[model samples]
Target: MSDTMTVKEAARLWNLTERRVVGLCREGKITGAKKQGRSWQIPATAKKPLDQRIKSGAYKKQAERLPLPIGISDYRLASSQYYYIDKTMMIKDFIDERPQVSLFTRPRRFGKTLNMDMLRTFFERSEEDTSIYFKDKKIWSCGERYREYQGKYPVIFITFKDIKFDSWEMSFEAIRNIFAKEAIRHSELRNSDKCDEIDKKAYERLLSGQANEIELSNALLDLSRMLHKHYDIAPIIIIDEYDIPIQQGYMKHYYDKIILFMRNLFSGGLKDNRHVSYGFLTGILRVAKESIFSGLNNLTIHSVLDNKYSSYFGFTCDEVKEMAEYYGVANKYDELCAWYDGYRFGKTEIFNPWSVINYFHNECEPRAFWQSTGSNDIISEIIAQADNEIYDRLTSLVNGKSFTTYIDTGVIYPQIKSNPSTIYSFLLVAGYLKVLKTTPSFNGDYMCEVALPNKEIAFVYHKEILQQLNQIISPSIAVAIQEAIFSGNHAKLKDLIQGLLMQSVSYYDSVGENFYHGFMLGLCALLSGFFVSSNRESGNGRYDIQLKPKNKKLPGILIELKAEKHGTEESLKKLSQKALQQIIDGCYDVEMFAEGVEMIYRYGVAFSGKKVEVMADSVSSKETIRLSKSDYRSF
Candidate 1:
């Protein structure tokens, strides 16, 4: 074998791309690889490195050193074989709270399924002594008062997290299969003499996959009754991601059917069912507005806005810090916090467990790990139907701003279209935004100041939420307008914006400065490397818009906008100059100057009907030019 080989040779020999080979060399994954000018030299004798792409179930085995459970939701496996955080204390909380039917509403991948399964493990009666999974954990330390419940009750566990389908028929079939699987798990009741003939027949129908809609609706109730009769104890019901199918139905135009089915399922299983010991459900939102739990008055909801069980769903600050120390990346705690630690569940600050574990698994590099964990269809739908006001607020959120809004934590799917204000509620429960401050509102609602949760969500919200502005203003127009603004081309900017207004705005919409402000704000939000702000205190007074470059080398920008009910192009031209003078007179460049911006661009834009005018000037700390009030006296 040759002592040395070029990256190209190694790539061909190892069946990898040359760029990948170069990366491996640079990362020091390729043994004996050395840099030679811009290229890499590798040892020919060195074996090809293992591919970093993980196949599904690739990490199922327990290694000599336990790996972080990246996707493991099974409580038994995750708690026993992985570096599990002891969440058995959640059991203690549930017992203490003792709600008859507790529903936990949290965002996807925030450990909802795992926590529910943990409940199943701690409470379900199993022949194999499942108490072993809880004895060494926090619940065991709480004394016999709490520990007495471990493995004591029959449990009916099912997850609808993956029950996504395009039509009602397929969705129902998927649901039936789920219940059949669960029924088979409890097949002992099929032959038990304690079970009545009718109950056993209903169980057999479920197990045989022959249950009709009405029969399936009654399945949970019948099974719970049979379990009670067979074991002489009522069963605990655990439903995880109970709203995933409903969300899918709303997205796919089968909302009514799914809601009917879910309503009936819960009604039979949970509402006044003496056969059920206790019921627990977890999902992103409480769709009680859908009437799914209409008469189930005993249901207790702990949403993202509630203080109960707050720390159980996601990693707390201390948990994350402890995890970092255990993984020997204690120094990366601040980075981890910045990227993943801004989620506020109730009053508790929470870090995304999925992203945190993946961060450590990926050797502590930070990225938007949680963004791709689930579908962003809700975000897409919200952005698609957003009004100008919604667009303005969304723009502010992406620009590191927060605003007070009413949050209906029990946000329904239909409200996404009918009630635009509910967007904040969806974003909050779906884990896109974090509450900065929250106050209780009427009837379980919340008035909260919310913003993009963390750097990860900031990146995600910008990419997922703000990018939807393209649907309103096309990408080409956005790019052209941005180019004109940055290049100091007043004529081009005016022409582009005027064309957009004429093409997109209604005659009614073109009459207000607020409309134009939101339009321009939405466009500016798409800009990269700029800290965009609107109606913010700058210089001496509020500036309509300010673009402070994240990199000081780029020029800073301040824009003041004006609108008139009716005016000629000549009058609009004069109004634009008046607006430009407002920037100078108000000293709007002071904040940028304080931030060490060497160059500034000030733009004045005016709109009347579809006609537009723009005036722009450059300011530099290196020089000063004074403008007289006579510049706008002609107006």
Candidate 2:
């Protein structure tokens, strides 16, 4: 529509001085600005940059906000002790047209455990009467059709969320301990009048935490029977984070052993087990049917693709709006959306609930909450081990582009080594990627288009890529480069680094010094025999990277990186030589000189796509020689 605003108009609209508005336009924070005779014609739709300054106020007592429940899994405790956005109505959905076995798979910390705990509270036939906890909750208002079922069933709930162990034996111990704890929960089973004699012995063994591995395998199924016998009704079973052992197995190289045990445990409890009235299991990925589910039947799976329980796993827009209003940060809702929104659970657009809570907890200041929670080693490993095809796909993803692949939500971990598509599927399920759209396939899986969901996740991926580059670049290459640098072979070192950058191009675009910073650091890191540090304070400035020989006999290498955005051949040469000059002027080698490192090799390398320039020289405090640059590119 050719809608435009003048600089003065922009200033008024954005609530800033005209000079400030013009500065923002020049800085490109205000997009679509064009200069027109000492005035900036800005896009009418352009918005002001968010002010990040922390507001200071007079000391005054304020009404305390109920704390954001960070990591508490018990819904009862979280709801009572902290500010909780209610998800209790999930109980109503479960009770209404219940599935025989419903498996809800979502990424970690999307309220799976808390929801399972809520289910346990609602249905567990406990002496403590949990109905009081739900008295004011959403489900209680629906009358007896829902209310009648409250506290009416024997619930067998167990979470394997933290079942990680180093050894199969230790993993079994974890399983055994879980069984023993559940036995204590239902200790009534130990003295059940209807329980058989041998069952009593096994129950005691399980309670004593001394059960054999075979007994532990049979524990959950047998517990259901005992609960049924004790309560005279079938038990509702909830197994939360069901893939922990399998995931741990995949990572720790004990897949077959854990798979065999898990296959038996899940099958025995849920597969045609007459003692279980129904079952609910939650996991991040639905481990493929042939491997884990085996011959089990009557299981209904709800992934992010399924609409029935979409809002159950993440916060809906309405829910977030309600929260923002209640928290008095309703005005900052757009900021929240920019960081945490765009996760899709079925038809519902979802916000990451964990990040939302953390934002409020930190007084409405937004940060990357979810990215810092885990190691995310899986994502790093996948990229580090990626084939050329996988690397190309990842590069596109990092560039804010979407691509389509056949998504089998049932990811078999072993297949990831051969099938690049499975890596995408794993990433999608693991909360690293988001599905943009999906089309039905003949095989019943979806042909899904996916991209990085938000800025926070993308930032983490950027960091991981830098880390992966550092890990993947060879130690031999680093050694070779070290020799080249110290031996006055600047040309050889430059070629080695350039080759590494070109290799990384298949996975990540060498966009700027940001990427190149990691490239240089990665190479130096492989030479662990030396003291290698990045961006440390020295002399007048922070250097790109510094290499000090641990042997103290070798000269230090000071590397400075410059990204070539635009330049002629002459300008490119000038940039590389200028970088070398910047290192000397900034005294980047001050630390090395003080430590009595008598010699130094300062190299300034500049990159422009595949074309690169290197200007390097060996310098000491007294004499600086432009190390025989016959083989190097000249400025």
Candidate 3:
């Protein structure tokens, strides 16, 4: 069957979209395909090009296309080879403004490095005409003003992401090594005939990694100076993930040492440096307290809240829509939105590029791909420090709700410890939460509504909640409490719960009824091996908890907790009895009856800080049975 086909015919024969078929023909990934005129000509017998989709068994099923740009940071490779989303216009915007020093702080895995690489590729004069890289991109249409700036200046690009280390000395060494590598790349500067031997010797020392701290601190400033001397133009400085070391430093206990070094390096390179034309720095946190950008007077910071440059890092709605249509998954748009959308950056709603790519590549099945890349332990640590009010707010967020609070974008390590709510800023900038709405409050600070970005980030909060409970309540104590509840040892259960409650109050900083409700939820985790459900709708109303034992012979359990206002014996007794009565009136046990359980244990616990009153009873043969003297307590 020797037949020739146009791109449209070829797309139908291959069961791929025409645009994707064209990409394959252009990249030469599809064999025996050729581009002539405005379209491509392909053999009718051509097979579909293989990619990550093959792993998902898409080829066997047939009719599949995947637009996944997986971790590729090289701008040329991504645009020329893969189906890259068009973010090249951001380069035009940057060159147009040309801020002396621009800091773009965004979350991890949000395409920050790739966008920075694209910027460096378009501007840096590396003895290569990289204008060809953007010729077909959107920046190409920006006309001569932006095009003339391409590859016209020397570039000094570096990343401090590798500064992640356990010790300060080791981290310093790692940074020195990064400069050394850059020096080796620019070793041609040593070979310049105009260079004298002494100046060349200084460069050799840097290449050998023999340069000390002071020398390395000024390394970038020195490099830019040398580039200016050689090329007769100031260089563009691009730094990616400049705060990784600082963030790691805070976590690893060497914040002071790293902050000082980073501050010096940034100061020398950025402040009053005549050889620097424009500079860009991308990091997760702004590092405000350390004065990392203190000496640079021309610095402009655009954070997550900023109206400018927000859509550059993450995928906008239109971008994702076009991508879904291109990949022939237009029907999956709603599912995609629920799983990966909800980030409101500036005026645009954004989608997680990392997760979207992973989903399309893996047959469009949803999974938590971004959170697994990093532990998010830093934000969780700060969440664990939350008081009862903040804890309830976080709980509401995990339950698919939103909360408004005063947000301070300039979060530092010290502030996280002093004011725990500073974690909101950290979490916001770090991509664990997204701002829904923002309005200026009377105090002059913006009140912002934040929520979990999507189901993926919701899991992060859920994990944090469990982590907080684990951090506060001991596993051994949990087991003892479980045994007491199982054995009907009311006294032991009371002692254990009171001890746990006091610990939460004094040590964990928990308070109010919300704290008691969460504590009771944690206690109910012991019944997870059997059947346990929390705050779920059943029968006539929502029950606090319903536990049906795995053993058919054992009694099902229903628990209701009431937070008492005063800890008097009379008040506690009345509250406990009222809680039990409400549980029955609400038909909380109707779920158990429907499940065919023959017997049931019902409990009403009244709590006020460390003090608690317990009342429990048994239900058998469809009759409410009074508790014995041992099962009832009011003190």
Q: Could you say which candidate leads in TM-score?
A: 2
Clashes of 2: 0
Please give the range of 10 consecutive residues that has the lowest summed lDDT in model 1. Answer: 53-62
TM-score of 1: 0.68
lDDT of 2 at 70: 87
lDDT of 3 by residue, 495-580 (tens): 88878767653423334554455556556654444565455445555566667777767878878888755477678767877777
TM-score of each: 0.68, 0.73, 0.68
Ranking by TM-score: 2, 1, 3
Which residue pairs in model 2 clash with each other?
A: none
Taking the candidates one at a time, how many backbone clashes does each contain? 0, 0, 0
lDDT of each: 0.82, 0.77, 0.75
Residue pairs clashing, model 3: none
RMSDs, each prediction? 17.3, 8.9, 15.5
Between prediction 1 and prediction 3, which has the larger lDDT?
1
lDDT of 1 by residue, 469-507 (tens): 665567898899998888777778888987876775354
Flag the better candidate by TM-score, 1 or 2: 2
Best by lDDT: 1
